[model samples]
Target: MKATEMRSDCPISSSLDIFGDKWSLLIVRDLMLHKSRTYGDFTKSAEKIATNILANRLQLLEDNGIIIKLPYPGNKVKGLYRLSPKGVDLIPALIEIALWGGRNISNTYDGSPFLKEVKKSKTKFLKKVMDDLLEEETNIG
Candidate 1:
């Protein structure tokens, strides 16, 4: 939304104001898994987010400086989306959420491998993931 529209000065609330939607974090998750993704790629996600909602989330994320939209190579009608550094910073939080879900949710999808990596050494896992993302952004630039 906007700075003036935030529900409170609470950090959590403020952050949510920017990305408190069902699909925004999913979009962020996809970018975490790849250097860049196209609109078409997002549409193909298992979540099957609607085109209108996807379009809106993309715009909202870009507006909030959480993602960067770039011209897709040799494509006039598509754009590549990747997380901005701010978005990358959310990885730790996402990991925590994943950990919680894995432990508390019933019938959660198999994510043992990743969870094991984090449980084995959260520091190392975060460092590698964040470093990889930083490298990807640098290379893109």
Candidate 2:
């Protein structure tokens, strides 16, 4: 979304403007767990996002520089999606939200190793996540 497209001057509003939709963040969450994913992978998500909406959200993310679309090796018709630096920056917020849910919601994530690591030491977990992403980025390049 462009600056003029924002609903207001508030930072939160601007962020919501870009990714307020229900599916965008889920898409980001999937990207966080996997360095790269395919369109088919997204379609297979438990959320069952429709193909059309998936295409639109993917386009919006790419347009906003939150994600990058790379050609799938040996498959001209397929593409791989990966988080951009801007997208990776959302990890902390995602982690906080996950923690909030774990505290207030059900035990859905109680068994998740990622949340366990985060609960153990958020700083260390975040550092490791960033380092891993950087390593993947370097290897990709």
- In order of listing, the candidates' clash counts read 0, 0
Work out how many backbone clashes candidate 2 has.
0
Per-residue alpha-carbon lDDT of candidate 2 for residues 35-85, written as tens digits (9 for 90 to 100): 789999999988999999999999999999889998887899999888999
Tens digit per residue, CA lDDT, model 1, 5-86:
6998999999888888789999998887766899999999999999999998998899888899988778899888988888
Q: Which stretches of candidate 1 lie over 4 Å from their true place?
A: 1-4
- TM-score winner: 2
> Could you tell me how far off, in angstroms, the CA of residue 131 lies in candidate 2 after the best superposition?
1.8
Using all chains and alpha carbons, the TM-scores for the candidates as numbered come to: 0.89, 0.91
lDDT of 2 at 23: 96
Alpha carbon lDDT of each predicted model: 0.85, 0.88
The per-prediction CA RMSD against the true structure, in angstroms, equals 1.9, 1.8
